[model samples]
Target chain A: MNEATIQVQKLTKRFGDFTAVNNISFEVSTGEVFGFLGANGAGKTTAIRMLCGLSKPTSGWGRVAGFDITREPEMIKKNIGYMSQKFSLYDDLKVWENIRLFAGIYGVPHHTIATKTDEMLQRLGFASEKNSLVKSLPMGWKQKLAFSVAIFHKPKIVFLDEPTGGVDPLTRRQFWELIYEAATQGITVFVTTHYMDEAEYCNRVSIMVDGRIDAIGTPKQLKQQFESESIDEVFRKLARRATRKEV
Target chain B: MLVFLIEKEFKQIIRHSFIPKLLIVFPVMVMLVFPWAATMEIKNISINITDLDHSTLSKKLVQKISASNYFRLTGLSSSHADAIEEIEFGNADILLEIKSGFEKQLIREGATNVSISSNAVNGAKGGLGAAYLSGILQEYTMEQLAILGIKPVPVIKTTESYLFNPMLNYKIFIIPAIITMLLTMLCGFLPALNIVGEKEAGTMEQINVTPVPKFSFILAKLIPYWIIGVIALSLCFALANLFYGLTPSGSISTIYIFAAIFLLVVSGLGLIISNYSSTLQQAMFVMFFFMMIMILISGLFTPVSSMPKWAQLITMINPLKYFIQVMRAVYLKGSGMGELTVQMVALIFFAVGANIWAVISYRKTTH
Candidate 1:
């Protein structure tokens, strides 16, 4: 297998008396599309937050992009990009301006920023709307733009938390095309989602139930192991036993 | 990276529909209107008089009170009961009663008493009105004694001269303080809202995930507001000079130096509030609560010397109090750094303390 981009062991996060992410473990290879699926309160976000260096785990440890999650969070941050569940772009900023801002923040070379921003805008077919405010764009376009900006720094791994949320199927399909393009360029994609069909697109999928990984395998392997015709049924069978209600 | 962050902040502020206009209009409106509305100098007290003795002395006293600009003779009743009724109905703030034997008693005994009653609900106005009436009566008695060809006992005379503000113009006293208040509100509230607004919009979460250091992020957030604050202070100074012909008596750079430190204290406080609050509403309420207490207790509208000892002690910790004192001293008294070292040191302490607290509280990662 290709070198592991993410390696975890017994990663756990607790909030007071409640454990948000239980002692779960997993790994993802370089350039693989890993789908992290869970119910509403199934601790997917909690685990993702730990991996993205946004929060510390209560116990145990993991590494992302070869940096210790706890001791080297800043190092991890420098090597990975993140797109949150909510729209996170500055709505008041112009399209090219937003691109230049993230590029500048990611330490893209100063002299090349203007040219790179123009090229990226043209590639996204957003060159015509370069001066328009981000808020003026439609939701699908905004999501696409946010995703593009997330990977603009060419990080080794990009963690996306529900990047296709609230979009129509056509937009989701287009967004997946961008993800596949990034993967082909050798960027690891760690995504969390509610859409089951989108889960079928992942090279490896993990279905989490009550903060525990109930199933983790290739789509066909999970379906075959669960004696089901599709990954959706496999997910339902594993998720039905969860005692934690959706929050 | 820090440059980019500050650029983004400036872009957001300029693109905001209301904030840019507010930056210009708010200070202009405050400078134009507040100096007139917020003056502490009391004028036009309505007085009621009951002159039972229609003698020359009583008549002259009545004329003297009426002629003074401070008092308007709103009522002239024959009885004290009627005069007191005007005060009860709120038409008058003070009442003076002259007995029927007033002039005769003064002539025979060389002394007489007149009763004075004032509605002290608005204590400053009422007290000052009664005091002016007493001065007028004493002058009338002295003139009467001279006309009677009676030699009076010698008394020591006191010459009063108001320092700093010879004319005692309340506008000149209040304008600098108002400017201090404007800086407090503008520099204080904007940064608090700026950070919390980013949180509410979820942009802060995105920024947190990046490799940007916390210090650079916070500095980026504070620097733009600091620039805006200095510009707002300049705008206030320009407007005050244009409309009221008021200029700081001291070096303008001295005011700027103190204003720069004061902005750090206020903006640091704002950052601390934003670091704790997650929503704009929560941040605004917390900021408003602190601002109300600070502005009121900072001696902006009232004298800190007049407050209770405990309240004065509280003002000792209020950064606004030190800044307002510095502003007033420099603008009105031509006080230089040598004369204002204590206030300067207090503000410096607050600036350092608040900024350190802000930087310490702002965490890049949540526990």
Candidate 2:
């Protein structure tokens, strides 16, 4: 039962005269941690947005979480959660309040919300600060809490857009641990990040450059194939090759 | 979906420090400014008393004109020369003068002429003041005729009455309009800014990527504001009732129903503004532009009929104009729902149409 949870076939997005996502295709399997690596404006966020049903592709098609992205956006929305790199929590609200709001928006049952909130707070070691305002929390705690809240609805697929952008390396490590935990619990993690070390933790990774995925493979295979010591070096070599081809 | 959005919205607004300012300051400003701005009672008018006859009759006429609430007597000149001076100086709006032998001629021949000159500035106020001055003169002339043996003159006397506001307190006429303005301004400005503020803070991108429906997101944005608007309207109503004795004379339930419709329409306008603007500054400018146009053309301070045809047509499209007219008509005239049907229809049209447009225009992708 290793069927693809997400399937993209010739997906392309255009804005006016400019193309944001060129003819690109990829598939993510169930319970797999798929890392999307790209620099800024690399179409990684655009591709992820298309998969999350937040954006419509100009041509081609895709299915996300067993639903057509184009035809059944609402159905797909119901089955996936999204955590943006911008950290979307309302800072004025208390930590628990933000969680409750997300839970309610996802239509979680009241009893389920209570238990899930309790479990989440306990897991984050934020039990004592549950009632404290979210703005008062440290950046790392907010990031971790944001991730937990995104997956709180038990969505089958979670799209994370650079979820660890500015966090310290230690916090980044903790974030990967949480991602691994979610994956072990059978949640598919679709993450986009600039951090190459984080790419090593994913089951598979796709590196995008200039609106197209330039490389896709396991981290070890990619490094070995590029004759590189790290994922960063492999990405640099691939990106250079892709740019050289453009010239 | 609406419930979910509204719950989060309430939480967000509750934690906002300036919410109390929004609820209290805005309505109070409206209540205070409405009475000052919206009035037909002529003030600072220049009167030129042309005393061609300088007799007690003409002097008494001048005194009577000066004593009335409407006229602001600029100068009391003895000669037509000085009266003309006051009028030409633009210092006086209405000019009154008694022709020479005015009292003796009226007593002896039972007919005397009094000359009146008006500046005609702010033509409406000038014309109204001129008519009122004629009425006052007619009363004085009648009194003089009674003193003499002017028999069987068949005097047609007029007993003056103010239609709705008998006391002629400007505040009474204005509070309802002010209430409508406060709701519209707050609903239109606050929610428009809130959404853009989220975008500015980079939080909207996060919220946008979520599975939360746009309808729910918009509803959540408006719920707290709608509640705040209700509170503000209530407080303004209470203050008006307590301090100004401004009470809704129509069916209170009907007024409230109309008010609720008006609130929804204005809130819909806010959502539309928010959707069009990508930044808080753009939203504010758009809202301010509409608010100014709405206030100017709303018949709040200016008569809709008095405007040019194109302006009148524009005013008809403005939701605030209809709501203000509805509010004033209901509160002062005790007008029935039947009388307010057109206004109610306009409000409903704006509310439904604007909200639908707002919802439809809100794209999941950034432009």
Candidate 3:
């Protein structure tokens, strides 16, 4: 059986009287592409934040890369990488500088950084742009570079939070190609996105509405079960059934 | 990790379009402008006189007062009320009311009073103006006594000694203190803006996910600016000495030691503000407000002793106030560590507390 890289059970999070991620449970196998989807303020961020070891769940339990979410968040941090919705690289810095900085922070050996960066640049076929400032890069190139930096240390899992925001459709498709490549290398890809069609690309998908996971299944299965033509309709149908308003 | 972080920080600072030039040029410009702008010595104080005597002695006194570079006779008031009006309406700094005393009084009694009134709106300006007026009157009295062949009896002489700065140059008194103020501001402001800029760019969120120690992150961010601040301070010292001819009387090492301690307090303050602020704009506004109040109450621009009692009490808690006092004492009075121990302890307490607060306040886990 494929090992469960992410195993979460009844994970819940609350802020005062409001529950942002209420009793959500799911798992993603090794090399699985798990898509986490929700409408605006539907608690996708809060749930993903908990599983990435960046936030503490209020109750229940979870494990990521064999580290307990509660007791070994630091160890978990060492095993996973994260990219946020907003661009996270220093725009004023050069491409190689950003790579070296992350490599250092993630504890990559100093001697190997130059070789690893060269390999990454060669793989991206953009060694010519390594010395250029990140701000001068195209939007699609910036998105691709950010993903590469996020997983540069070879964490067991990498969480992408709206990683393809504000990019053209062709670039968005290319971004997914990168995600698929990361997965093929045995990195668990946990991504949250607003694009409905992208949800179909995941090995397993979970839909969150008003702090609860409304559905979890393969894209074909979710569509067949909801009697819908596409995951978009399934999402819209399930989203309308949520009794609570977006917090 | 620390080395890498520091390298990245320095690279960003250097590559940014406007920051490196600003940091280097800021202190040089402040040193140029502050010594001349921030001084207690008055110049060209406008004066009004009502010389009622119409005699040679009184006319000579008026000429003597007006001839000095310190005073300019703006108007010759015909009556006492007009002279007083000139002072009240802000047209004059001082109104000299020479009453209707003929030159015969000085000839008979050997002494006569000249009624002088000053607009003491700003107490320091008025007090210095009065002192200048007194010096002219004393010189005139000495001249009259010498001319009349009257032996000035019971003459008490004061042989004065002005230590440290014999010339009493205001630049000598203030250059070191201005250095202290400029370093504090630049060091504090740069890191404040920088940390918040990372947050705005969302780079902080990525850093937050790493297992990087909170203390190391804060330290790595502040060290570059701290180094810049110290280097900038040393260059300012050299500039002050070369151009303005102001040098510290105390050991240069002592000033550096104090600066290192004080920089911790300043950079920690900046980090704490950045940790609390969510956006660059928010950080900028909050820092601007705090900086204005801190400088105003720091005794950098004004004498803390001259402030009201409660305000003076408030100054004791201000970190910049202690820094300014230490700088002035060391540079102007050659005050030793024994004299500066209290400020040192206060600064140490602030450095520890502010840095501890910054580390604790930095949210490693997402909210």
Best by the TM-score measure: 1
Cα error of candidate 2 at position B220, Å: 4.0
| Alpha-carbon runs more than 4 Å astray in model 2 | A241-247, B48-90, B96-114, B136-155, B160-171, B293-329, B333-350, B365-367
Q: Which ten residues in a row have the lowest lDDT in candidate 1 chain B?
A: B147-156
Q: How well is candidate 3 docked (DockQ)?
A: 0.76
Comparing 1 with 3 on DockQ, the higher-scoring candidate is 1
Candidate 2 CAPRI-style tier: acceptable
Rank the candidate models, highest lDDT first.
1, 3, 2
Tens digits of lDDT, candidate 2, B1-367: 5675677677777667987666787777767666776677776566777676767777777788788877777777878777777778777777777778888888887777776667775787788778888888887888878777585357666778998989888787667767877787887788778877887877776666666777767666656767777788788888788777778888777777887777777787888888788888899999999889888889877678999999999987998888888788889888989898888888899878877777776666543
**Regions of candidate 1 where Cα sits further than 4 Å from its true position:** none
| Reference-based lDDT, each prediction | 0.92, 0.82, 0.88
What TM-score quantifies how close candidate 3 is to the native fold? Answer: 0.95
Q: Ranking under DockQ, best-scoring first?
A: 1, 3, 2
Please, what are the lDDT tens digits per residue for candidate 3 over residues B1-367?
Answer: 9999999989988877888888778888998898889887888888999989888899989999999999999999999888888888888998787767746677666677787788889886778888889888877877887798766545577888898788878788778778988887888888788778888888888888888888889989878878888889888988898888777888878888889989989899899999999888888888888888888998887889899999999898899998888898888888889899999999999989989998998877865
Cα RMSD (angstroms) for every candidate in the order listed: 1.6, 3.6, 2.2
**Which digits, one per residue and each the tens of the lDDT, describe model 1 over residues A1-247?**
8999899999999999999999999999999999999988999999999999999999987999999999999999999999999999999999988888988889999889888878887887888998999999999999999999999999999999999999999999999999999999999999999899999999999999999998999999999899998888888998889999999
TM-score of chain B of each: 0.95, 0.86, 0.93
